[model samples]
Target: MPAGLTVALVAGEASGDQLGAGLVRELRRQVPGVRCVGIAGPAMQAAGCEPWWEADELAVMGLFEIVRDLPRLLRLRRALIARLLAARPAVFIGIDAPDFNLGVEKTLRAAGITTVHYVSPSVWAWREGRIRTIRKAVDRMLCVLPFEEAFYARHGVDARFVGHPLADELAPGGDAAAARRELALPPEGPVLAILPGSRRGEIERMGAPYAETIAWLAARLPTLACVLPVARPALLAPLQAALSAAGVDASRCRLVEGQARSALVAADAALVTSGTASLESALLGCPLVVAYRASALSLALVRGLRLIRIRHFALPNLLTPTPVVPEFLQAEVTAARLGPALERLLTDPAARATQQEEFGKLHALLRCDASRRAAEAVAALLPGYRAPNEP
Candidate 1:
């Protein structure tokens, strides 16, 4: 292994921040005095990464949103490229945010720097043509999901499945009773967890409908307790306003700041927006219904172009041999539709138990020590690299 190695990492969102932080810790352990520099969130900074820019700067989502912010994003990318070229790190790893990172990786790789993309772009799902861009951008691709490795292999790309970091972080067989006790909730009643998403745009799009679904559930099951976990402090006001607008009573619901995992563990079921949270709900063994709604233009463009390839959108369903959870998208994501799915998970013991059984299997499949495996993959790209314990 190289001494005093410098590795550049760019993580564009909260999930990527988490993956980057974990990978940074493992890399530091594997290579003593390793220097990490790039765009980072608080987690990565705490893990000893020097931030050229905050992760939130690159956190814009959706086609319309990206188009609006294109100029600023392009400028940021140019500045980052110049700085990285000057420093010439051993490897550059872009964690998630494929749209932004892939372009940077291509430029850096073209400059003769080894580049790794930490998360595979959804080439299997939409815009399959991105595979060629990915092939040009990365020396190696590190995927968190098991199926992605096979997809990359079929395309003849150098990739490895590091398993999922969330699976490793969460314990198998979570105790709902204990989580409820910690939240000071009754041990006997049904509780539903609502996680619209972590981003502001996500909250704006899905929060109102999710709150309405909660309201519907509350009326249907009088004893129902709803808990919403806010990922960031900024989201609290918007979420509360959305719930209020939906005529949801404050007494029937509790708004907790952070503790998303605890919220999922405590709930009998979850109403989650389709993204990383769906995967988290599954790993926590929380029976859930995944819901998503985008802007009219975005949905039209996606459907018009016929971009999606897979049959299922939810991560749990995608990983399972069969669809284990129900999904509502676009026009189908109505409170009326989502309410029944949540009700079933809350009321039907057989259904919840079956989902839990499937969740356990999925958990086992993804529980490989992900951070260490990812570090080993990144380390392999370095000249004469060896594991810390290796000769």
Candidate 2:
């Protein structure tokens, strides 16, 4: 069969790449021999996308960081728009990365191409004004959270609660033994997994203190081992340097390229940096202590940003709006504070079990099977787009 429709999908970061990969697989399954192309990481490439460029290079975070890289990003985006318009795909699917994808999508939509933004921008949080921009860009918005549907409806943006791909991907049970063996962990001791995020800026700002917190906890609890899962080896150099500079041994920590699922599943508890990891940790049934720190400028920008309805940050807590996880931010983040908080989470079996049970409920709520819904939404835009698994 020949390709009847073409899809240009753009996914800027690791999380977005994972979502994009899932969407691609579903698109192929639903509409076999669909031509997929655009900026993507390895996973999406494996799903049969001919990359216009590596999606990693497009990953510039925070307002200030993006400002510094604006000219390059703009040039890249313009080139992308041209290629996409030339190819004239049946639809353009922008997966997350709202700051970057939304603008490109807006341009493509104005040029008469059907546009779909896979993940809704956080209008439910800060920057509610962008809902209008989303309406301008996207014909349909696929929301991962249930509450997001109401949020979009209030803002007059078309949306569907398509559930989260993570819930579908994560198996309920964990493999602690496999994780321990893979990382050469001690067979009988409790383990603490540390995920400080994948960005370079995150490592530089929070690395030293996070490592110090690990060392502090290790000293107090002789039986506890620290497992630091590296998002990328490049992001780990600063962390490794911090361990060396602080007179701590790197041998005390295990560094991994990824396998965040394994690390979280194997751990008794986690010291996670404030993004998607906290959510993954919950799904893995790991109790968590979330932490984050950014430069004054970026932090200030975040502080000044006018937030709306969303009150919680972590997904587990956000889902229930209950005090299920601990989030330590900026000024409150200290080695002394973090270590004790981590220790407390580790020691309390009842609390940990309660949180895990809550996460299980959250998982069931989010396991509504998103890809087919998203594909159907996209198909609604094409000439004769038929959804294979229509709901």
Candidate 3:
């Protein structure tokens, strides 16, 4: 449509990288020779994004973690702002990394550059005050969840729900028997998928509790097998140490690298750290017990500030009218709590079917060709932009 049109993007973590990559591919298809540049990971780089900085540089988690790296992050943001302002791209899309990208978006928007935020921060759940900053920062807020569009509209922000890429990528009711065969586990017995989390901080907090949960479940079910999927190779050492400390038998548990979806598909139930993985587990037709423990100081700050607004933390629960999945947070995220919840899902057909039924409905609501919709929303922000099929 336009010669050498450039779209600037910043994706802070692996999930955002994936979202950015899909958006890049779709944007390229719509506008030939569109150049994408910003902080990107391998996926985005492979999708033809020229990275000014790697996405991992901004992948810090937790309040303490971000505070620890604040100076370096601030420097990176300033430099990125300067670069994007100078380059003057047709549109600047902040994929995720709201803390970093929101400031960048605000600055760039102030400079008259069209700005869009791809994945909304949890303003609807916590810190609703951020709506003021979001209104200033984003020309259009492209949400991945359906409910988020209405939330933003009530606040007078220009927002659109483009649906979720994961819904488009993963089919409902995944083949458990086939996935178990692929993972080399017995196709008959009850298998449990344990996804601690992708971040090191998450693993550090969740590893022990997850290991204990495995031990608890294994004691109750003699035929139980556990599949622990490490989101990255770096997490293996810590995960192994945790399992060892809990005295979980090595023979009963198998650790695979980067096959979270397959692990979820293979298992009867999952003990998932409350984040995107929990949603993944649900989407793959696996019932899950969601658990999470934030750093003490982070929890203290959130509590002191009264930042948290919602009753449910799990994505599947938040998406639906009522809580479809059980969630345990803070000190409640222990073997005692997670064990029984997972046990019910593993043993009771009714509980599993109930969650699975809700998951199927949720999947249908979100399977909206997300990347293409996001690309269209982004393109609409560009000057004199028109759809390819527009007459």
Candidate 4:
């Protein structure tokens, strides 16, 4: 490794922060004293990446939300691009946040710096046409899912399936009793994990329905315990307000800060939002009901334009050949539907076992030591680079 080797990165949310942290650790191991810099979070910062801007600044979601924050985002991108250009690192890696990162990568790549996108966007689903833009922007795409490599291949893009880091971080079927003890939850009752989302917009739209579902379920099972994991400190007050308005029993529900995986481990079942949280619940072997609600205009455009390509929205469902979990979207995300779906998981042994079995298979498929593989892929892009194990 060179004395002044540097790698640039940008991770937009908590999940991406986790991914970025893993990638940074592996890169540091492969090349000692490698300098990592760009937009980062606490996890990535702890892993040794110097942040040019915090990841939270780029956390806006949905079409309307992005529009509202566009001017500020553009300014941030322009400044970041100029700084990165001056640094002239070995390679630039964009962890996730395709909308923001891809543009940054495209500009940097045009200036003769190599660019890599860590997570493949949902081109395999809706917005398949974005492949054209991605082709010009990314030198390589590091995919977490197996099928994504082939999808990019057909479009004449260079891609590699690096597996998912979460699959490697978490084991299949975690110890519920141990996790319950650590979280101070009831040791001998059916526990349910509720994860609305990591973003403010997501909780704003889904919190009411999720709170109502908890209230509905509490009425049925006297011994039912609930654990809700708040992704960020900013979301705590709003989530609490929603639960209070829905008349959910504050005594039975415990709100933990940022230990979502632990909350899922302690839970027998979960009501998870339809993105990374749904995937995390499945990986932890917790039976779950997946639900999502977005802005009215965004939902309308997706539905009216017929932009969605797949029948299933949840990551667990998309990963499997057949959908194993129930999902409620938009208007379908109601207490009436979500409550019953979760109830089945809690009460029916067969239903719980079925989902768990499928989850186990998916977990095995994705546990490919992803961080090392992603590091190797990034290493391949640098001039005169060689793996430590190689001759």
How many collisions per candidate? 0, 0, 0, 0
Q: Write one digit per residue (lDDT tens) for candidate 3, span 63-125.
A: 777998999999999899999989999999998889999999999999999999999999999
lDDT of each: 0.90, 0.82, 0.91, 0.91
Worst 10 residues of 1 by lDDT: 382-391
**Tens-digit per-residue lDDT, 1-391, candidate 4:** 5687899999998789989999999999987778999999999999999999999888877766799999999999999999999999999999889999999999999999999999999998987888998999999999999999999999999999999998998876578889999889999979999999988888899999999999999999889999999988999999999999999889989998988889999988999988888888899899999998889899888788777898898999999877999989888999998999998898888999999899999999999999999999998887778877779
Off by more than 4 A, model 2: 1-3, 305-309, 388-391
- TM-score for all models, in order of appearance: 0.96, 0.95, 0.98, 0.97
Q: What is the lDDT for 185 in model 4?
A: 95
TM-score between model 2 and native: 0.95
| Residue 250, candidate 3: alpha-carbon lDDT | 96
The pairs that clash in candidate 3 are none
